[model samples]
Target: MNNINSGWRSGILEKIQGRLMKVYLLARRFRKHIKDLKNIPRTPRCGLSKQETIINKH
Candidate 1:
């Protein structure tokens, strides 16, 4: 029957919408985490620079 077909279509659409919402939520969470990390200041690492040579002078 046409009504049965419509019901099936509606069900499929609902499942697709649910999946899309879950993906959107995950993307938003990832974006927020990335933004938080970006806001943190990173200190530059000096690998055996002049400061260490002077300090280690014998």
Candidate 2:
């Protein structure tokens, strides 16, 4: 009877650990995605080099 109880407890613990690992992985991916989004606006827009040259001539 004791062995059965111990086995059941270990099974539950394993399930909990698996769930935590999944959440941690998801959080890491989310952080990277957020970082990429933050960089998008800081990047210079495309096709503006011609305007920049005209302005620089002044």
Candidate 3:
């Protein structure tokens, strides 16, 4: 019984660890993407309407 319990617990722990790793990887990728976006230069729009430019800002 004890061996079965330990096995079950380990299985659950592995599943939790796998899920945490996936979340961590996704967060890292998202952060990198945000950093890349911030590094990009914003060019001035020549002919866009004020409302359009404002909308594009966000």
Report the alpha-carbon TM-score of model 3 versus the true structure.
0.66
lDDT for each residue of candidate 1 in 1-58, tens digit (9 for 90 to 100): 9999999999999999999999999899777755645544452335334434543562
Residue 6 C-alpha lDDT in model 1: 100
By the TM-score metric, which is better: model 1 or model 2? 2
Off by over 4 Å in 3: 43-58
Please say which candidate is ahead in lDDT: 1 or 2. 2
lDDT of 3 by residue, 1-58 (tens): 9999999999999999999999999899777756655544463444235534544564
Residue-level lDDT of model 2, residues 3-48, one tens digit each, is 9999999999999999999999989977775675566565676535
Clashing pairs in 1: none
The alpha-carbon lDDT assigned to residue 17 of candidate 1 equals: 100
TM-score of each: 0.66, 0.69, 0.66
lDDT of each: 0.69, 0.74, 0.71
Candidate topping TM-score? 2
